[model samples]
Structure formats: structure tokens, C-alpha cells
Target: MHPTDSRSLAGNVAQLEAGRQITVAREDGFEALKALLPPPSRRALVLIDPSYEIKSDYAKVTACLRDCLQRFATGTYAVWYPVIPRPEAHDLPRRLKTLANQSGKPWLHATLAIGQAPDRTTPGEPAPRPGLLASGMFVFNPPHTLKAALAPALVQMEAILGRGRGQGHQLEAGG
Candidate 1:
């Protein structure tokens, strides 16, 4: 009973169980992802990587996300933005907040930075590794069960990705 015909960005149709879903579209970009959902309700998850530099794109992403939130009965939004060496990273949460506020729904938001400690010394290092210190997944409207499912994986990814003192961390819901 599952819909196994859906494709992904790589053009592979998944073989999932009944009620399982998969989508692969490039025309509309992320909007295509949102369009795959059937009306009425279901949990929603959004993951943005390497946060787009364009404010307009970010606004669109948040708008589409807000629309999904309002349309769904109960869903969580997970937006992943890189902890780049810049000030804009700090402004993303606020921008998302503004987007949600405009939507008039109380959406939870969190930020996590995955990369080396900015204060670490690199005197003799050939060059600082370009990767996350501790990649994080920020969730808004997260399900109660998500924490348990992700906790272990985060630890593992952090340990593998962290340089010196890698610690894949979760900021938790409402933190």
C-alpha cells in the first residue's frame, strides 16, 4: 500500500512500506518538497543546509515552512544552518522568528553550531579543517519522540566530526 513511485533528487524511486513517502523534484526546488504533502495533516520536517546567503531565499524558505505549519495539524520544523565564521549566522534565528511571527503561530526555534572552537590555537596546524565543530539540528514543533531518536546519533556524529573535543550536541526543545 505504500507509494513507491516517488523519486528523490538523485532520481531513485524508494521502496518504502505502506504510508511511507518519498519525493524528488528540481523544478520548484524546496517548494516541490512542500507540494508533495497531502492536505489535511501530517508532521512536517524541514532541513536547510549551508544556509542560503540570499535573504529572499531564506524568507521564501521560512514562508513555505510557516505555510506548512499552519496547514498541518501537528508538525515540527527542523532548520539546519551552518555555523559559519560570520555574524549573519547569529541573525538567522531572529529572521526565522520574524517569519513565524508574521504567520501568527507560536513556533519554537533553536540554533546549533558545528565546527571547531573559535578560541582554539592553530600555531603549527597545516590549515584548519573545514567542517562542523558539532553539527546541530534545530527543531521547531519537534515531536516528543525525536529527542530520544536523535540523541544517540548526535553524539556519534559529533565525536566523528568534532576536532579536538568533538561533541555532536542537541539544544533540545524549548532551549
Candidate 2:
């Protein structure tokens, strides 16, 4: 619930819902996360869903996950990223995998594509193109039953959406 933009609006909305449960911080989520980690936390589910407005967000996400792992090796971490043509989006899953490997923990990656693949003619094009074709979530220290639970659901969603060519769901996991 740590939203960096439109701080007052976000904080107000959070307060209306569950003021005590949600701490709406007007700061970078990575920094907020750092302050909340380590000694005090016994077990945690850290979800890092940053707006990739800047390419540096990708690297920051990776770096934050790496540092978090060092502090809380057993914490369950989930990262959500768009599935676009950008190199950062494409490489995120691999980077997350590398982090999971370093910690010797299992991770699960799931992607859902609601439409056809985006055009890639322009290699250096900026992201957040006209259409949002796909999105993905990478989960470190995933629950054992997550894959089995998500597979059929994603398949059903793809079928319902009438997925186009090269448009479908993907689930991958490893230790």
C-alpha cells in the first residue's frame, strides 16, 4: 500500500478502506520495504509491483529483491511486471530466477496474455505502448500448491478471452 504518486489521494483512499492496516507512505516503495525488513519480520509476503515508467525501475526491483533475500531469505516475494517488448520486461523473469537460485529457493512465474504480441519493428521504442497485451507475476518461495491452482485458471481465462496467436498463459517454476 506504499504509493509514491498522488500521495494525498492514495493516503485518503487507503484510510477510507482500512486505515490501521494500511500504512500509506509518500516515499519510494523500495525504501519503505527496506525499513520494514529483517529483524522484526518472522515471515513476510513482499509484493513489489512498481510502475515501470522509468527503465531504472526494473534494475531497482531486482536490486531490492536481492537485498531483501539477504536479509530475509525465507520471505515470499512476488513481483508483477508488464509483458511488453522492452528488454527490461523480457529480462525480469530471468533476473528473478537468478535471485531465487542464489538463495536456493523455489520460484514460480506466471504470465497472462490477453491479446496478440506487440509489434517489435522498433527495437528502441519506449514502453507502455497503445495496448496492454500481457502481464506477468514472478513469485519467489511460492506455495507448493500455487502452480496447480493457477494453471487451470489461466487456461480458462485464455480460452474465455479467445486468445490470438502467440497469446496465452505461461507458468514456469524451479528451485
Candidate 3:
């Protein structure tokens, strides 16, 4: 996991336990990912979960993913992004799919919304839901079994986690 903030990455009043191996890097993750991209023939899974707190992170995520595909088009890149009311959030999935298409790769995109985006009455009105109500993951060059496997799981997640009328899950894929 590429955590942007050291504090969140270090947080442990509870002392987290881990089964899988982990290596901590203090530098920027995007630059690190660029340096690590293997050849197009190599098979690897890259999970990119950025905070998206900064406006530039939206642009950076796509740029970095595009750069990675250029280096390793066959690699599986799983990018997790928040689903907020912001235009950037809404546009990201579309951007990712375009990149995958350009690289001649398949992608599976899934979203899980636990809360609804509240109705806005006026243009200047602040969102009733301040934080993220939904989030999504776009997987480029996903495994053949992934879509079939995740479909049922997402349905279960929507049933279990849904809280409002618009709260649900969606899965879309393309080559």
C-alpha cells in the first residue's frame, strides 16, 4: 500500500497486525512506480490508491498510469479512487478506461456507494454529505476470473453496506 502521509501510515494506537510482507518508502509513490515498471512482457499487479486530497493527484494518477502502461502494457494496474461530487472524481474512471483502450488492454471498473450524494438545491449550496460517499477501483489487464468473482461480491457488498436510495454498486468492463 502506497500511503501518502506518514502519520496515517504510522498510525497505530491499536498496533496493526499484518500477514503479507510490507516495505515502507518515504518518497513519492508515483515516481517510485515509474522506476519500478517492468517490460511489457512481464506480468505484475500494481495497486495505486492515492489520497486524492490534492487537486493535482487526479492528474498525477492518470499520468502515472498512462506512463506505466507505456512501459508495461500487460501489467495489471488496480487504481482505487474516491467517488465525490467533484468533476475530477467523476471524470477519472472515464480517463482510466481510455488509457486502457489506447494500450490495447482490458479493464474492469467497479464502484461501491455506501451513502447517497445528497440533492443540491442551489448552486452555492454545500454538499449535505461532506466526505466521500462512494469509491471505485479500475483494474487494467485484470485476471479472467476477476469480473466473475467480483460481481457477486459487489452485489453482496451493496446489500450489506447500502444506506440510502442511491447507495449501491456498479461494475463495468471493456477491452
What does candidate 2 score on TM?
A: 0.79
Candidate 2 lDDT, 1-175, residue by residue in tens: 3345567766577768556544555668898888888645477778798889899999999999989988888888999999888999899989889988987999999998887644565668675544777899999999899999999999998888744776788999999
Please provide, for model 3 over 1-175, each residue's C-alpha lDDT reduced to its tens digit, 9 standing for 90 to 100. Answer: 4454655665642255641233345678899987777844376788888778888899999999988988887788999999987899889999999888888899999999887644766888765644577899999999999999999999899888777777888999999
The CA lDDT of each predicted structure is 0.54, 0.84, 0.83
Residue 142, candidate 3: alpha-carbon lDDT: 93
- The alpha-carbon RMSD values of the candidates against the true structure, listed in the order shown, are 6.2, 5.5, 5.2
User: Taking the candidates one at a time, how many backbone clashes does each contain?
Assistant: 8, 0, 0
Model 1: lowest-lDDT 10 consecutive positions: 1-10
- Which candidate leads in lDDT? 2
Error of 2 at 44 (Å): 1.8
TM-scores, in order shown? 0.61, 0.79, 0.78
